[model samples]
Target: MSVPQPDSDEVVEQCENCAVKTPHNVSIKLITESNKEENTAFSREPYRITECSQCGAKTRQRMNDA
Candidate 1:
């Protein structure tokens, strides 16, 4: 398996629980491919998820181009 993108480690926006901008763990996963293989270019985008350090809330964040 390939390693997650470097920037995926960054903390996403503010936390929903405590409303604090804290560092959180991040996980990345590739999206599943659809039957329409020809249109799979954009569908391959990975999900960048973040967990709130203060209250343990999880949120999905958009990834920036590397």
Candidate 2:
């Protein structure tokens, strides 16, 4: 139940085409399970939530490997 987020000092952005600016209040939730990780709830944890302001289309992508 560990959820990550952007810093409070960070600013929210919107789609460039919309021309309308608003907070990225939208959320993208994701969880993945694999046979190899038998007992785990999710093998692939979502890293980031990307959202579109105008149409509200969203996507979740894995974070970069360190």
Candidate 3:
């Protein structure tokens, strides 16, 4: 469930390993859970996964609906 982001949309985020702001490849994933009950509804949570282009360190961030 990896969502692709265009190069123009790339963001500068601090890398935990590098300890500095750097360009990162960002992807989005939708997490969902459902119950066995017929009428039960499922919830979808979107998260952003960022990987540092330089060090390849990855981080996950939960996204909030605006």
Between candidates 2 and 3, the one scoring higher on TM-score is: 3
Off by over 4 Å in 3: 1-7, 33-41, 64-66
Residue 17 of model 1, lDDT score: 76
Best by TM-score: 3
Candidate 2 ranges with C-alpha deviation above 4 Å: 1-11, 14-22, 26-30, 33-37, 64-66
lDDT of 2 by residue, 1-66 (tens): 222243553335654545555345444455564667575674666567766543465655666435
How far does residue 61 in candidate 3 sit from its true spot (Å)?
Answer: 1.5
Q: Tell me the tens digit of each residue's lDDT in model 1 across 1-66.
A: 222232456654556776555667878877644668687776676778777655678877556557
Q: lDDT: which is higher, 1 or 2?
A: 1
* C-alpha RMSD by candidate, in order: 9.4, 9.3, 7.4
Clash pairs, candidate 3, are: none
lDDT of candidates 1 onward, in order: 0.64, 0.52, 0.73
lDDT of 3 by residue, 1-66 (tens): 222343676787767888777778898987664455563345667888898877789887779767
User: Which TM-score value belongs to model 1?
Assistant: 0.48
Total backbone clashes of model 1? 0
Off by over 4 Å in 1: 1-13, 33-44, 62-66
